[model samples]
Target: MEFHYHRTGPSPDLATIEQAIAQLDPAVLVDADDFARVRISTVLDEYALLDCLWRAGVQVAMGELERQPSVCCGGCGG
Candidate 1:
């Protein structure tokens, strides 16, 4: 699973976001444009990661945390 985050105003520094991500350790920092996408394995991870971002003052857009299908290898049948 993946969580996408879009900030409303000036984006937080990369280090700030990186610190928040490290605390939860749920996902990998995938991509960043005006928004950020992270790949996580479980629903609980999603909640925890979001909480971490919020606590770190990320100011993520509400309802922007959409889940997308993860990349898969056919051999694993994920």
Candidate 2:
């Protein structure tokens, strides 16, 4: 799932966010818009990712951000 993390002022550095994402369970960053926004992919349930971000000093907005559906087909028994 994707989430939008907002900051009070200037966005945090990439390294900082990356460090935080690392703490979460299998949270992979898909993309980011400067330091203000970020897109992530994770398999954690119950919004645990948000908790990780919060602990990392990043405030994530409520609700999961929407992402375009993937069209790539990679031999999934299709």
Candidate 3:
């Protein structure tokens, strides 16, 4: 899955975000722009990565990320 994040104004360290992405498994730092645009690919622990970005002073674009659809039937709970 792909994830996107951005920050207001400018961003300080792409290196820091890169480092965090490196340390976080199942996550890949796809691309980061100087204007504070970030793209990542991961199949696990997305929230953890988002938190990491938040701590790094970046804002996550939750709408850009794909959400898992509900497994329940259209008219049934199960």
Supply every candidate's count of residue pairs whose N, Cα or C atoms clash at under 3 angstroms: 0, 0, 0
lDDT tens readout by residue for model 3, 1-78: 556556466654766765666666534545767666566665446677777666666666555454444343558422
What is the Cα-based TM-score of model 3?
0.52
Provide C-alpha RMSD values for all models, in order.
3.9, 4.1, 8.1
Q: Which prediction has more favorable TM-score, 2 or 3?
A: 2
**Any residue pairs clashing in model 1, and if so which?**
none
TM agreement with the true structure for every prediction:
0.61, 0.54, 0.52
Prediction 1 TM-score vs. true: 0.61
Which model is ahead, 1 or 3, in terms of lDDT?
A: 3
Please give the range of 10 consecutive residues that has the lowest summed lDDT in model 1. Answer: 35-44
Residue 50, model 2: lDDT of 66
Q: Please tell me which model should have the higher lDDT, number 1 or number 2.
A: 1
